[model samples]
Target: MIYIYLYRLPPNSLPRMNKVILVTGANSGIGLALCERLLCQDRQIQLCLACRNMQRAEAARSALLVSHSDAQISILRLDVGSTQSVLKAAREVKQRYNRLDYLYLNAGIMPNPQVDFKALFKGLFSRNVIHMFATAEGLLTQQDRVNPDGLQEVFATNLFGHFLLVRELEPLLCQPGHTAQLIWTSSSNARRSAFSLDDIQHHKGVEPYSSSKYASDLLSLALNRHYNSQGVFSSVICPGLVMTNLTYGILPSFFWTLIMPVMWLIRVFTNTFTLTPYNGAEALSWLFLQKPESLDPLAKYHSLTSGFGNNYTQPRKMDMDEDMSEALYKQLLELESNVRKKIEEEEQDTRAHGQYLNQTE
Candidate 1:
């Protein structure tokens, strides 16, 4: 359910400028890498690191201070899985920062990941797999969790929560005379097999993580179409294969070490397998330096590394169904409306209780 309020721009103000960039999931991994790179290059730029864990957020801020002591970094606790948390965090950010220049919606999760080495080994010799798994290009696995929203954990955490956050922060995003960019981190693993419009949440036994990523890809495209003219520019980026904490969770720590040689070998053939966090953040870092109007609204930008380990952007056409995306958007809007009404009802009940207490006193 994507709720968008359109704002008509005056003919005089066509170019909107932004000075602050907010990134979610900035406590570690590629998010942290983007924060460091952005802060190092621009002294005046305000970088807000939005994370779920306060301790990790503080540590990330401390680490950023090492390179740029005077970096304008703010930590906002945002658990995208929870609607209440997202709204509260948005309100707090709104109070603190009047206008947002860029929003890097990079916070995502692939929980309870399990690798099928057997499938990988089979794929090595077999030519049957038309769509390759992200890790080995044959098969992948995942562990399931029930989300706070009573949806599949991966779908809720990875897509729905972010969807809600964007809806909640719509006011701050469409600030006049400011071109706000919503950059989403998508993946090459977003295959057609992963997503089913019939069972979008992946509750009917499927690779929920990949399904969620595919949904996000569609959602971002839908957002761009609906809101590009309203001072909101949406873009999605596939950061390629990066060895990060999320990937580490899929396999044992020793597995990453043992497969280092194989990974390096693969890097020779396709340099997009960025072995380091520094390499992974290159595309996201590049976007921060780009003008909003200069960016393509419909194309998903891919972050790939060259043979020399240099970063570059490659435009890829996504297999997106416009009808499915619009359907998802409508469903989300209904969910949002119901959720908002529930919140309003709860608030009214609390207020009524308070008045009753005052009268009794």
Candidate 2:
């Protein structure tokens, strides 16, 4: 990964007056880092840090205020793994900001990973392999149970929930004059082999996290194709590997500590492993300053850092299939419609009961 600065902002000249940006997974890691950097660049930008834990969100806000006292930062509780939470979060955003300028979909998970280091080493030495797919690619993992939405937790959180949120907020997102941009925090770990049209949810013994991320990358491409003409542009980026809290939890603490030195050495060769949260967040921050039409909607951006720590964005080869993306899109549409109908029916039932009681009174 080479540090190629596609574009850069002059200074504190970010157009913050008319832009209200909302970022999911903003309590910590790359999400929080992006929020901080974006705010420093332009304190006038209103940033909504969407997180599941209100307490953590408050803590993050307090920390941001230490340096950026005038930054307009707020929190909206959201859990991308849950459909109910998604709808509730969207309603809150709509109530707060009538028009959204940028929506950074960065909430994701990789639970209970079981990576075969033997296979990894073998692949590393193989003729076809250039580097170890240690960060986000060529990894396999399983998460917890299916969500209340009756979808795999990974798929629901990483893709479906975000999809529902975008659909619900379409009115605000599709504002005229290139007003809105959807940036998906995708990964190089997203492999085409992990995804199957016959089993998009990974109900079988498949790795849900990798499959879901790949689905998301494809979905992002499909979204740009379907919605770009309507003023909504979608882009995906693979933030080269970073040592985040989420990654630290995947393996044993002792192992991570012991391997810290080796990790540093690896960083020298693999520029994709940005090594710090700040560098890992460069793609999201870069997208914030980019003009809508200048962005390549179909290409997945790679956030890379040079050996000397300069941040840049590189265009990565995305394995996108329109037919598969369309199939997944239709399936999600049906699922969203069904869930909305069920919620509406429940509301109607409560209303009917109230009316009957009123009549009896």
Who wins the TM-score comparison?
2
Per-prediction TM-score: 0.88, 0.89
- Could you give candidate 1's per-residue lDDT for residues 78-124 as a string of tens digits? 99887788889988988887788888989888887777888866764
Best by lDDT: 2
Candidate 1 overall lDDT versus native = 0.80
lDDT of 1 at 191: 63
lDDT, candidate 2, equals 0.83
Q: For model 1, give the RMSD to the true fold.
A: 7.6
Q: Report the C-alpha lDDT of model 2 over 206-235, residue by residue, as the tens digit.
A: 578778888898888788888988888898
**Residue 40's C-alpha lDDT in candidate 2?**
77
lDDT of 2 at 64: 92
